[model samples]
Target chain A: MSGHGLVLRNICKKFGSTNVIRNLSLNVIPGEFLTLLGPSGCGKSTLLRIIAGLELQDEGSIAIGGREVDGLRPKLRDVAMVFQSYALYPHMSVAKNLAIPLLMRRLCAWQRIPVFGALLPGTASRKSEIIEEVARVAKSIGISHLLDRKPRQLSGGQRQRVAVGRAMVRHPAVFLMDEPLSNLDAKLRVQMRAEIKELHQRLGVTFIYVTHDQVEAMTLSDRVAVMLDGELVQVAPPQEIYANPHDRRVAEFVGSPKINMIDVNVCGGRLAEIGGQVLPSELTIGQGTLTVGIRPEAFHLASSGEPNSISAAVRLVEHMGSDLFLHLDLTGVPDPIIARLPAASGHIAPGNRLHLRIRTEQLLLFSENGQRLKQQASVTPLREYAR
Target chain B: MKHCRLSFRTLGRHGFLAITTAFVIVPFIWMVSLSLKPPEEIFQASFSLLPQSWHATQNYIRAMTASPLPRFMLNGVFICAVIVVFQILICAPIAYALAKLRFPGRHVFFNLVLVSLLIPSQVLALPLFILAYQLGLLNTYAALVFPFVVSPLGIFLFRQFFNTISDDIVHAARLDGMSEFTIVWRIMLPMAVPALIAFSIFSVVGHWNDLFWPLIAVRSQELMPPPLGLMAFKNEDTGIDYGPLMAGSTIVVAPLVLVFLLAQRWFIEGLTSGGIK
Candidate 1:
């Protein structure tokens, strides 16, 4: 089946005086998986609900498959949503849960009665068709053995798969998932994350996934839209969002253990942090104070008296088997800067002094208002100091 | 705490419960005993839970064969069942809207339901009578059932239960293409088995045991529920006819007791599960 593209234009929703979604617009190409990634209360789930037609946008229009669906009901929108709770009907068996959307769609009202439904013309065949499809989806999701059981009898992950299978039953043009894996334990979350990516690949359908977890968004989507306080801050590929984020918020929100932000004074053609020389750079950032964004992995070990290095005492070292996360306290800097180094950088512990140098190419420079700026750097390599 | 011998506190608590249990159960024992006793022993001054001379067979046969007692009981069953079913049908939808849907004046409407609950049925009896008479529903089953078709307490109770259910389930059902009524029936109703049982018990017990409304609503013998029919039976006899009356009372209460015993588990759970308070 050909996937349908979705276009949301000028969507604005207000919960009383507070704007939940403010003039948001985004376009999803056919057969692409796009994730709405944001912190909680960032209106990501609200956006998904608005797209599913479960909630109306106060002032916007939504078009799915090139048709405006502003007034259509959720089922008529040709989109299915898997809710955060999975929302599998707890009373229905897995098989009946899978058959509901098809039953509700294919059969007329007269043909939905319990025993009399079968006697009506075309109902018997349609019911068998529904049953067949339900079985197929159940088997595909590895929940065939669970068809006879109620949702409460199944584990959280199994219920989650059944929810996905229910959505897949109709083969809707677009699939909307609102934090479907947040309830599962960590181990199952990782396993199901791969399965969801595989499902998107297999169906080749437009998928809009909303989540607060950056790891899920980072690993799953073709494009990640970072939202904050009811506005889309940046929309780009996952690697681009991580490597060259549009602004400081996107950089801080995406990466784990957070990117280190140091406010540096660009005084007299040198980059200075806390009145110490970080490096001499010639990129014009309009001279004054500039914030330097550094991912924890950007720092490398250097000699104590390196010209571009800042000397710091190791406050803590966390071993992650392959790498070490060192919480270092630089002189005159209040917040400790974390550096992820190879564990083979031997014998590092708390109270040890080391000089850390910022790599020029990996340097992220943001303006005073937290906007990313140009970086065509000319770096002067450091001179090592004598004891 | 786990392995406990008889402590003074436990003993005292059990003693208090036993005394209270006897106080609650003594009247039921008296009714059954009077049903079984001869008329002489029933009227005698001496008190005993068991009958000395057993006249149970005679009293029961007379009560059954005396005056359309079986038909009165059949009427009770039919009316109570209809009231419960219609109460659920009417109350569930209203409760679903009040509990889940977002709309203007929703809280006002819910507060109105609570207000309606405060106005007792006795206050509405005269107006209900006039309405039923105007509609030509007098002395019919419709008059008996229609007045109770929409119960404010049922709406209030069902709404309280529905609030415990997650909104995501409803949204998912909507996306699954089920209509609001279908969701109420298939999704909300099944999950609300406890509340259904609890409300059904309250409605059935209330309507079945009610003599005042039935006396006011229906004059015909055929339409009379058990309590009203039994009251008629007592009044028609020249004397008290205490034995047959007590036997009939036992029969009238028997079905309700059996039903409560059967659904006793769900009944208690329902009341306490998503409690009103």
Candidate 2:
């Protein structure tokens, strides 16, 4: 069977009085690894459940491979789901768990009754075929030796692989995973992430992965949809999301050590004042106050007054082996300004006064309402703002 | 001083435990003693712990012949089995719905079920008797088994067990292209075995010993359960033949004790998993 792309149009879901997903629409291209990246309570898992037919959308329709699948149940959708808990059947052996879907498909309804099942005709041939298929999938996932073991007998990582194998045996067109790696310890999480990525490539199936981990989204997905409070805020490539975040929340949510944002008052023209310093004119003044975003890596230690420089005292220094994260105390800034510098610089120490030279091009400016300011081409990339 | 203090504390704990154990064991010891004693010694003011003479076989024969005890035991077993099977059928699906299925009024339904938990079964006795009378089910096992088929407590316990099961298993089964029914049977039910066994013990013991419902529902001697049969035997003998009555009571209690001892591991495991949280 060919892997089918999925399209969700204006999907709306509400849990009683609370709206979890509001008019959300998305598209998953065939054979593409798409990730829904968001913080907890962002409704990413809810959206994936809707696509898999595990949940129904209150409004709008779902189409798989360009066919409306609104009324069909989960089994009819040809979509497989790997759950965060690794939902291995506890009593069944690994091989039996993998063989269950095939058995359901091949065996007639009456043939499945416990006492009469053995008496049914063609069961032996069908059972052997399912076992063969299960073995093949188990071997592919390097779990052939574990076929006789129950789910609880296996370790966390082994259970996860078996969960994937159980899904893989079905050869579903689209695979829906809900935080599949969240249960693993950090080291195992990283290892399993690579294995899932490789499996996706080898299987060439449409993968819709959901995770609250931005790092996982960035590293594993070809495209990422950032959701917040049940709404899709931005959908783009990982690099684009990192370099050109559409909203202030996206910028804050996507990075480690987080981006530092400061509020600024705009005078009439493109000039804005921040921290009692008269900044150069690079943006046309909008209707209201604006917020400027500065990434940690954008800050550098400069000797004296530069075109874009701020004065501060070193509050703390965190040595990260190859890099140093400096926490600087600014005069008017409410939160401490963080800067990432190369370990070789060795210029920062707690209580030492310093001048922070910021790469003006790398600086991002946002409106007071948290919308990104469109940058003009002529102005330095970081300094420019929308008219 | 420290050693003396520690020794005193340990002695007090063991003393308390021994007293409690004796308190629980006294009634059982008396019942066995009465079962072994002759009628004349039972009414004596100065009581002995053991019987002067053993008439265990003779008492058992009279108890068996005095009432339809063989039939009564059969009735108890049959009613308990019917209740358990019906309870499983009715409660399992309802539990699945309460635990996993999302629909309108789910919390309201759940709260209503919780309300039922607060109300004791004794309160329902009169209404159930009346309902059975109206249905013309009096003197039949239907009256005894029908009302018990749907146990609110069973539903609540099974629901709690089902909820503890990871939703991932259900989702995985769904993606495996298994129907909702298959997911319930193959996925949810297997995980719910411990709960089912726990419910069975609750059901079997509850129905086996119950005298009130069957007492009210059935007037015929043939349909009476073991407990009611013993009650009938006492009434027929004018409360004088203590030996046979005690023997019958002993017979009635043996099956329950044996069953409990045999399945104590499963019973405790199931209870701890399903009830103790």
lDDT for each residue of candidate 2 in A262-376, tens digit (9 for 90 to 100): 8766667455554434444456665457888889998887776664467888899999989999998888888898889999986667999888776667778887778888773
Error of 2 at B243 (Å): 2.1
Note the DockQ of each predicted structure. Answer: 0.86, 0.73
Give the residue spans of candidate 2 off by over 4 A: A273-282, A286-288, A301-311, A330-334, A376-387, B1-24, B61-68, B105-137, B219-221, B234-239, B272-277
Worst 10 residues of 2 chain B by lDDT: B175-184
Per residue, candidate 2 scores C-alpha lDDT tens digits across B1-277 of 9999999999999999999999998888788888888888788899898877777778888888878889999999988999999988888888889998887898898899889979978899899888988999988989889888888888888898889888877777777767767766777778878777777888898889998888888988888888988898799763778888888888888998898888888777777887665
lDDT by residue (tens digit), candidate 1, B98-185: 9999999999999999899899889999999999999999999999999999999889888989999998999999999999999999
Instruction: State the lDDT of candidate 1 residue by residue for A1-387, as single tens digits.
Output: 868999999999999999999999999999999999999999999999999988999998999999999999998999999999999898899999999999999999889888998899999899999999999988888999999999999999999999999999999999999999999999999999999999999999999999999999999999999999999999999999999988899989989879988887786655555425445566575468888888999889888776666678999999999999999887766799889999999999799999877676887878889898766543454332211
lDDT of 2: 0.85
Q: Which ten residues in a row have the lowest lDDT in candidate 1 chain A?
A: A378-387
Return the clash pairs for model 2, or none.
Answer: A270-A283, A361-A382
Which pairs of residues clash in candidate 1, taking residues 3 or more apart in a chain or in different chains? none
